[model samples]
Target: MAPLLICDNRAEVERERFVPGTPEFRRASLALFIASFLTFANIYITQPLLPLLVDEFDITPAVSSLTVSLTIFALGFALLIFGPVSDAVGRRPVMFWTMALAVLPALLAPLVSSINQLLLIRIAQGLLLAGLPSVAMAYLGEEFSPRALGLAVGLYISGNSIGGMSGRVISGMVAEAYSWRASFLVMGIIGLVGVILFYLLLPPSAHFKPAPAGLRKGLQDIGEHLRNGSLLKAYSIAFVIMFSFVGIFNYITFRLSGPPYNLSPAAVGWLFLTYSAGTISSTVSGRFIDLAGNRVAVILGVLIALGGVLITLLPALWAIVLGLLFFCFGFFAVHAAASAWANRQARRARASAMGLYLLFYYVGGSFGSTGLGFLWHARGWPGVTAGIIFMLALGLLLGLTLRDKD
Candidate 1:
């Protein structure tokens, strides 16, 4: 498919961007990094608490997974609106206020008296949380110098790994020690602090030019992106990889918390320490993409992830831990590579493009969390493994079709 044409004026395209070693560059990078960290942390805080929620609320595993699924479900659709809104207005304010508002839901979560109430709070939080991720990538793609773009994007994604891991770890530990409600309170405090830092650190957009603002314009922009075969492949890759990743993590809690293992919530949460591998891989992937290109990075990630999934089939706890590390390593590599590739491909309406990508990303997560929860409920880990393997194979097929940019 032909690339979408949305380039700025020739002079603007050639202008200087936030470069490494500069104070402004440092501030922008740190700001977006924190944006990503807080967004993912708040979004995933309930993951490890799923079992506890189930027990406390007297729900099934599939129903309990909705706490995580519904949040992502709302975030996915919200990206559609937030992306274009940011493009019409500005990236900074959208990110700032949404993050600030999201903290309210986290604080409210502790007061939720019913499962329905908790899900509503989670959904509201998801809507507010979309502001950062939906636009942060577009902001970086528009503002950062081309040479620095991959690195900036990589570092930003590394925050996702660290945030997801930390949130899960903290929630699990805190929930076990005190109560699950306390876990929400702690995450809210952290999110509030992150919002202040993000506001102070991130420089206002210097290069952003306004796009046409309206529902019709936004929908049209989305349509153009949808028509591009290359962009679709990237979106498909996102869906499949996230499905596999969320599917494993969601069910693994149940797997480890029962029967042969019988690990506590805290111990299970500690297992997410394996996400450190993703942190390392995501950071290095920027440089790797500079050298090897997107196709290779995606293919490599898929193979590693597949191997990791297989390793978990072994009964030993060590085997499960090793599998998770490999899965995380592979997951982030594919995610970072695909994310950067999609933005680079977008000629205009960059945020809308990223929004489309995220819609698929979280929709995949929702399906995995809920779909695999049911599968796990019915057939256990083997069923979940079979499901992930199928999705990964599909992802590999799509990954193969993505061409390196000319």
Candidate 2:
């Protein structure tokens, strides 16, 4: 009788999940994509504005980068709380309310009188922004059928790439034409629209079974994840990917903004059009993973990214653009593979698993954004390249350790 009751409950949960062809699935997918786009666009909108901030605030390159770095650092810390909180309360309310509130900080950015004020606003924004990514994956894990989950995750990340690209591009162009403040204003508007659409379209979670709510349980789950060597490897790969990608992009603006190129902020922003490659690769990597397995796919991604990094070393604008293209492509490939792996490897407390992954992910971005600035000051592009190379090598070695079973 007990076994039969358990079986019935499991079957009911599966039946309640969103199927691929259903309207609910489409709505949820689109809503999740928009949520991701909103999150990333706001997070990265300030990236291209680093040089402009340097001029406006009369600060060093490293100091100007703190606007981006501190936000990501705060986001990283926020994830640890939001992930567990969502598990205890619910996914939809946490995601929706936080996302709606995050807009305030973006609106406030334009009003800041000093760099410190701007940084404070960014930090506030980051803290609020964690509600989405920290729980979105887990939401999908619970709401979508197993067959649809891969493509859903792929599309979700494609939104991330597009959002990140558009934000930078918009900020650069807007800043060039008007001012950096206007860029934040634009982001805030888009965010408001996103929040409304998300609320309307996202079906409430029907399958989420709340975990026991407590700090001790959250810590225990985190401890279990830490004990899993497989998860640690994925975390390491995530760290290296963001570290290299952010480090390269953070300083590349300075390179192009100065020297022979002397490209304006808008021009530098256009180069991120290479991120279209990520959109394509992320969407397709799901299918590729089905055919090739995680190990092969990730190794290929690393090699492609590594090759792209080397290509940038050439002393030409074409080389740099081409390298960025390859780099974006490979970066998404690695992301698609590793993120899925992290989701699959964790058998329990799925949101917490994702939170841990993102904690490493953004922490890496924070480090890359700042740590590489000193390198830029000293050795320029070559030094940044060396640092990224060492990081990717570690990523490659870590990729090698992943078994196909994952």
lDDT of each: 0.91, 0.91
Give Cα distance to truth, residue 269, candidate 1, Å.
1.0
- Cα displacement (Å) at residue 48, model 2: 1.1
Total backbone collisions, model 2: 0
- Residue-by-residue lDDT tens digits, candidate 2, 1-406: 9999999998887777887788999999999999999998899888889889999899999998888889899999999999999998999999999999999999989999999999999999999999999999999888898766778888899999999999999999999999999999999999999999999999998888888878899999999999999999999999999999888888999899998889999999898888899999899997788678778878999999999999999989999999999988999999888988889898999999999999999999999999998888899999999899899899999999999685
Residue-pair clashes per candidate? 0, 0
lDDT by residue for model 1 (70-171), tens? 999999999999999999889998999999999999998899899999999999999999999899998898788988888888999999999999989999
TM-score of each: 0.96, 0.96
Off by over 4 Å in 1: 1-15
What lDDT does model 1 reach? 0.91
Q: Runs in model 2 with CA error above 4 Å?
A: 1-15
Lowest-sum lDDT 10-residue window in model 2: 286-295
How far residue 135's Cα lies from its native spot in candidate 2, in Å, is: 0.3
